[model samples]
Target: CLGDRAAVALSRAGHFRGRTLFSGMLYAPLVMPEVITGLSLLLLFVAISAERGFWTVVVAHTTLTMCFVAVVVQSRLHALDRSIEEAAMDLGCSPVAAFLRATVPLIWPAIAAGWMLAFALSLDDLVIASFTTGPGSTTLPIRIYSEVRLGVKPEINAICTLIIAAVTVLIVVASLAAKLSKTQADNAAPM
Candidate 1:
């Protein structure tokens, strides 16, 4: 969340050397191979002497997810109207207050989409989790892979189908809710 917000702030700033540098660094992770990311994370844990476990997996996934969120939010920020934030500040709102009251509410759909993308990526991740996970810290993807190695089971297909359906339903519901709220707000607005 912080990364996404920071990306928006930085991207909104006028073009500069530092912004260019930050954008390069931010997008670099997206192009990096999963194997390299996994290996690098494993090394970092080993170097720090941090115990590899659930938290480590969580950290690794969060790192990966942040990059994705940053991308989504940046694009949204680019298409946003800067005048709204300026108007808020001109109307006596502080810079921080302007962000919270004007910017955030308008860009909420993008933030939500980014969050959902991050969640789905984390859920489907296997390569990074494999490197970061300790014994007994297996994820669903890992478990499914292991099961596939033994033999493909019909029940596994059913479970995968159910998971896909659940995710699809969640996405549909969220979209419908967002649309309903927008319609309500529009109806309540004065001409």
Candidate 2:
């Protein structure tokens, strides 16, 4: 929800003043090193006297991934026809309603893509997770790394295999869905 709203706001930033600065701040994470990002988050948490745990990790991952999601959704938004939203607004819809009804449907695929990307990044993230995580909140990647330090085990191999299989299935399903959506759209178009 936060990522989607940020993407929308950033996408519409060009219409407002200070677009460059706003865009730069949002996109900074994309170019910043993961270690630096993690360190900064850790420092912030410490400064705020916030306990590092699952929630902190969640926040860290969200901060890291939100920019990526924004980039993906922003690209789709840029490619989208503004007139569809404008037409909705012209026909008595409020601006927010026009965006929700007209723009969101068109950008649904991008939103899904962004979600998938964020999930994948969070799942495998070790550095940021390490910095933000505390006792009783170990993530899969952190656990895997710790297990590997003692030596490669069959259980670890099996877990890795399962992760690979799951990711492969997700990719295949997403591709088929995209193909089906495209076919349906093509068929629905006027001759």
Candidate 3:
């Protein structure tokens, strides 16, 4: 939520500050290894004298995933036609009102997609979570890794299978939702 809102607000601000700096930050996480991101975030936490706990893990995950969300949202924004918002404004809506009413509906699918991506990344993340998480904050990926370190068992396989099935269902649902949104957007367009 924060990532999408921040990206759109920055993009709306102007060219240089928005396009260059935010774009660079977003791509930096993509290129950097997960270990490096984890280490850097750990260092940041240490510097701030913050305790490693659930909220710390949440913050670290958000920081790492927001860049990905920003990139996805930004690409969608770029592909979005500005003319729609302009037409809304011409119809007597304020700029903010036009963006909220005319623009948001069109790009909502992309936002949802980015949010889901961020969520999935956070879900399976072990490296970063290891560096940032404290006792009692163990995530599913960490648990799976631990189980894998022991010999893989039938129960583990069953659990893995269930996770795969869940992820598959999520993907199918998201795809259908995106397609529905696209159809609605098409229907709403002026002839």
Candidate 4:
């Protein structure tokens, strides 16, 4: 939803294509060191916070997270069936109506999966969060960092275990949901 808007805005403005920029921004942190990503975002956060306060963090997070969202969403869009969309249009549906009704429903699973993955990634992201988070806003990864730096503790281990568990759960849930959806689609297919 937001990625499409950003891409369109960029396209209309002639600044840069959203797909290229979004892919670059999102991949930079993932490929780069945590310190670099964190430090860069930190500097950005500091400047924005000084100028705007709490909302700055939100903006920063969005900038960082939207890339991942874009990648996932883009993949979903690529896997979508264009024929269904064309058929909808031929059946008297407007282009917009076809997209809203036929296209969106078919791609809904991928869109949902992408969003969920993005959200989970944002939640687990240490480097980006460290850089982008304000002084008063520390996320779970930051808390873990502080604890580990100070000394090893059972609570830290417990927290780490929980994070791993949560990630595993999310992956399993997404996988199962996708599998079920695929099965349903296959069963409905003309055989």
lDDT tens string, model 2, 1-191?
67788888877755678777877877888999999999999999999999999999999999989988998998999899899999999999999999999999899989998998999999979999999999888999999999999999999999999999998998899889989989999999999
Tens digit of per-residue lDDT, candidate 3, span 1-191: 87787679666767664567666776687888999999999999999998888888998898889888887887788889999999999999999999999988988878988988999899889999999988777878887888889989888899889989999998898789879988999999999
What value of lDDT does candidate 3 attain over all alpha carbons?
0.86
Residue clash pairs of candidate 1: none
The residue-by-residue lDDT of candidate 1 on 1-191, one tens digit each, is 86676677577767766777777766766999888989999999999999999999998898788888998888888898989999999999998899899999978878988898898999999999999999978888998999999999997899899998998999799889979989999999999
* Of candidates 3 and 1, the better by TM-score: 1
**Which candidate comes out best when scored by lDDT?**
2
* lDDT score for candidate 1 against the true structure: 0.87
**TM-score of each model, in listed order:** 0.86, 0.92, 0.84, 0.69
Reference-based lDDT, each prediction: 0.87, 0.91, 0.86, 0.67
lDDT order of candidates, top first: 2, 1, 3, 4
lDDT tens readout by residue for model 4, 1-191: 67544433343345554656655665564466656766776676566556433465556556666656556656666666678889999999998898889877866665676567667766767766655666676777678888889998999989889878987998898789879989999999998
**Candidate 3 least-lDDT 10 residues:** 9-18
Root mean square deviation (Cα) for candidate 3: 3.0
TM-score of 1: 0.86
Comparing 1 and 2 on lDDT, the stronger one: 2
Better of 2 and 4 by lDDT: 2
